[model samples]
Target: MSQTPLLPSRREFIKQGAAAAATFMIVPRFVLGGKGYTAPSDQLVIAGVGVGGKGESDLASFAKTGKVRIGYLCDVDDRRAAKSRQAFPQAKYYKDWRQLLDKESKNFDAVSVATPDHNHAAVTLAAMQLGKHVYVQKPLTHDLYEARALTEAAKRYPVVTQMGNQGASGDGVRQLQEWYDANLIGKVHTVYCWTDRPVWPQGIPWPTGATSVPPELDWDLWLGTAPFRPYVDKLVPFNWRGWWEYGTGALGDMGCHLLEAPFRVLGLQYASTVQASVGSVYVDEFKRGYFPESCPPSSHVTLTFPATKKNKQEVTVHWMDGGIQPERPEELGPNELFGDGGNGILFVGKKGKMMASTYAANPRLLPLSHNQEVKVKPTLARVPGGAEGHYAQWVEACIAGHGNHTVSAPFETAGPLTEALLMANLAIRGYDLRRPKTTGPGFDYPGRGIELVWDPQQLRVTNFEEVNRFVKRDYRPGWQ
Candidate 1:
């Protein structure tokens, strides 16, 4: 069977539009003249999917670069898209991304996807299939399979791709890398990443009843690839991060930002095994609540990675959320802040320790003074504007085309990093697995107290088959 082509071959399309293409092939105005003389046609045309909140800010940042033009804006909710619409008044608008891509693929050179976790894969895959460079929000996709798929697709599609974990472009992570390379911290063997996330509700039952769908919101389109359900209040915008069908829990929300540092500095890849323990919610004085549809209130997950060239010993990475924190390093003053108070990443090495705040910002060697005392020559090339430079980096890379430039968190790196976080989620989800008891109405929690052995090649929990359902989720009928 032959697969239907998503878009006409690039070669054929260019050949068919030879006359029109020749007009755009002229030398850039900047090269012909001087600074501030770039041709309008030379600007990178972008289409933003989910242009609201963070998406709006992302698009705005790209436009601020003066080298990018927001050519299209798309979102399921008009209320959310309104600001971006006003901000980029010249851009065309669409509520459905599919329609936008189908009709405007030629009008835009790239697409920015900032949708909820579950819908990320479908939209990104479609965009890549059409040969559009993509900048997707962090935790790249909702499920393990999607992350892996997007990673592999980046190679096959011949397009520049970046995950929105902007910290990957920050200087702090590079400083950590340089320090580690210089043996400031001798052979890191353990890493702890913690956050106070899920500021929204989790570990609770879904809202009791559906609310009337808002006139400005298209609930069906908003649901996208997830299973259909009546619209509920407060699920849009941000609260959706706490739901399993829509979000990836706290890990999905913050792991990419917190975990990217260790993964990069330590040369970590997929985890060999993962185990987790999650906090439960109590519905009453004597009874604990069981909300299988929602994420836990808190979780502590430990993932073990195989030995890599950077670290000869197996590495253990710990993730905690919902306000849980690791022990304060003894080398620090008692009054010093630990991980910016609410979130942080810590690396424990044989010789010393180091920590940083969210987005790998404000990195410091243990004892504070070491950060100022130790001088290691900078080795990694710094991104122009550091974390903020992440946007321009993508823009320039897109202009350069695929295989010609490097991005901070390309899918090749993000896929495995995201999968590691999602794998921890698999353990978290598996820890809550319940089955009806053979002889009674009660349930048995069978997945608890087990270390899930992972087979990266197979993308499954080899030791716990039942928990593998999360590896690949089922999209709704039309979505697939």
Candidate 2:
């Protein structure tokens, strides 16, 4: 099928006309012509779908790349998306992302997907299939199926793809990755990652309002492939991250960032088997529909990794959210102690331990201390400017295909990482889960936790038959 064509709006035309007038009216001698110089060969056009919130920041950075031009802007909520148009007045705006792709396909060489988790795969898949490079926000997919699908599609398309785990490129992250490689943290067996997210619009009760939809919001488009539901303001613009239908709750929201370091350093993929344990502080929160009743409040999710060909030892990566953290590692020092609402990832190897945040700028590394002493090294390996540099690297790759670190979290690597986290998510949806066996390729539930052997091919639990329904979603009529 032919892709959508760009429809130039009257506002956009006027904006462009004004820009032309300014460019002509302003004299170059006084305006500093050097800064606005455009390379003759540099012409990589890009579009941002969902250009508000974080998307706004992404658009600004991409615009600074100089080699790329922001050609299209898309968002379902027109009111919220207004700032995007003002930020990049030259770019065209669209209420429906599909229409942006269909009409403006040829206008952009690549597409940046900054939509909610539910719409990531649909928009990314459509753009990638049409031979457009995609920079999708993490976690890459809404479900295990979408993760695998995105992985396959990436292989099929010859395009430069990157997941927006910006910290993956940070100096601290790279240093952490290097430490793992050098065996500074030897034979890493366990990892603890946490984040205090949904910090913005979290703990929202189930939305109860009139069925009437807002004039500015294309309710159906916003819902995208998720199930049909009445219009609710709580789910629009930004709050969707706390809901099951729109977002992946806290796990899906921050897992990619918290786990990126471990996954990248260890090349971790989907868990061999997965299980989760839930601890609810308030029962009424679940009953009264405070927060997404479908998701858990506080939970401990454990993923067991099988022995790989290279690293012939299995590993376990644990995830904690909603103010839960792992038992403080014995190596952490008095000053190095993590505080409340801390976001960091710990890489505990047989030798040493290291932990860092999303930016990975200031990592706390522990020496080989038996008594669990926190010793901050005076000088450590430095990672130059992390994601800021990574962004530039991608732009260079997109244009010249020449850069030192070109493997910027492409789908091949991102898919497995996303799938692993999704497994944790599935474990949550599978009711109260239990820990897997201390040893084995399968999961073992103790008392309350349910043991569900994951089948990657079928995308379901082998023994627990009920989870198959949550494997994928049925989109609304027109959306599908």
Candidate 3:
């Protein structure tokens, strides 16, 4: 039997590869094609700031494009980052995003920010300021002002940007758009969006006592722009969604997926007026309260959007969460699922009605059978793999450079959508505003009865001054 040849050692393989490459080195496109030259054929190098949970999955999706590389990984918790470190073994690791950016900015072409809502703006803005493309997670930022600032930055800096709402690139939304455009669902006046969320705890007082911080986690760094609080057990990895400082609750979590369809189909922009009502929780045995530190267990918010170029006539959008769903439609069989059971979106129009499930998936005309009867020409181009293609879409767009190709959910579009959601939150929070009573020892909930009129251009609530504080929250020390 012939003996098998031995493989080269790591050092020998590197040296041999280097020698072989030196003989016929290929120049990079930027070097050969000159400044501002990027094409679909080129590769995209990305630095992931929050590489765990959704962050880790986001990076994995990007790398799956086969035209991208994960060059750096950063996360506050070492334990949370263990899987990504093992997957992207060649990537440089860091506990601080600022340090990663400062040291390796020159080596990467784009940045993917899947951090909590509070950290999205600072990391994304810094990357854009460096002229790097960015893909940020949903809700975009912790507050409205940050969303607007990043929206403006996309214009100021020549960089391609996309929000992490993959549903925007789905074929379902396009079909909805086509149906609407074909007048199948004529002049939609109202939309109802509902979700079963807060899979984490909410409506409870902040946990008491300080738990010892995990050795693998950097508590302070995790806080980012949010105010510091003592570390508590089970707050990391998940459960932060119920806290006001770190998350935007169910609306922030599911709004993007459910709202994108209506926005695209009707061309909705900012809301003109917003009103809300919420379910309350009792801190003790006696009285009900707003536990402003935590998101209410459930809420129903109403928003009126003014006429835009694409959608004439005002539209009313209802946002429901915490298992509150709209009254069942009288269209068909009782056994048929309503909006994929737990989550759904229903659009009401003058001529007919249509609906879709979360991520704008499973679209159907009311009566169910109308779906097969209706016919509308598909006018929009589709992303190759639909929702699954979202990551690769951004990669190819970054390679195509700013303005050369359009992404599904660019910052320009995501900003206004995010602002509208945050606007609704103002009402939920305002429901708890207190004032010292004129005579007695107790406080009055003045914000309960009023409708907060919005001034989108000025970016403030014209009627309620108290809730404006949430629009542009102060950054923690040194974060600025």
Query: Candidate 3, which ten residues in sequence have the lowest lDDT sum?
Result: 1-10
List candidate 1 segments past 4 Å from native. 1-37, 439-441
lDDT of 3 at 459: 78
Tens digit of per-residue lDDT, candidate 3, span 1-480: 112111234575455344223422435667778888865435788999999999999999999988898889999999989999999999999999999888887678899999888899989887876668999999888888887787777766678899999999999999888888888878888999999986988888888986999999999999998888889999787888888899999988999999888888899988999999988887679988657888989999999998767767789999999999999889947999999899999999888889999999988999899988878878999999999899999999887777988799998999888988888888998987889999989888888899999987677888889888888887799996
lDDT of 1 by residue, 1-480 (tens): 123242346785455445334434556666877887777877899999999999999999999999899999999999999999999999999999999987877778889999999999999888877678899998799998888888888766778999999999999999999999999889888999999997999999999775899999999999999999988889898989999999999999999999999999999999999999999988999999999899999999999999899988889999999999999888888899998999999999999899999999999999999877989999999999999999999999998878888899999999999999999999999999988999969988888978899999878887788998888877899998
Across 1-480, the per-residue lDDT of candidate 2 in tens digits comes to 112211224564454334223322334342354666655334677888988888888877887867678888888888877888997788888888888877877566778889889889888877765667788888898877788878877765566788888877777676666556656667778888886665645444575767677888888788889877778755667677767777887888888888887776677766778788765545364553323244666677888887664345788888888778887776665666562237777777777777777545566676435225533342444424566766666666666431334655888889988988888888777763335578886554442456668877666778776566567776667774
For all candidates in order, the CA lDDT equals 0.90, 0.71, 0.86
Worst 10 residues of 2 by lDDT: 1-10
How much is 68 displaced in model 3, in angstroms?
0.9
Which sequence of candidate numbers ranks them by lDDT, best first?
Answer: 1, 3, 2
- TM-scores, one per candidate: 0.93, 0.81, 0.91
Residue 309 C-alpha lDDT in model 1: 96
Give per-residue lDDT, candidate 1, residue 318: 95
- Cα RMSD to the true fold for all candidates: 3.5, 9.2, 11.1
Q: Pick by TM-score: which candidate is best? A: 1
- TM-score, cand. 1 vs. native: 0.93
lDDT score for residue 315 of model 2: 83
Largest lDDT belongs to which candidate? 1
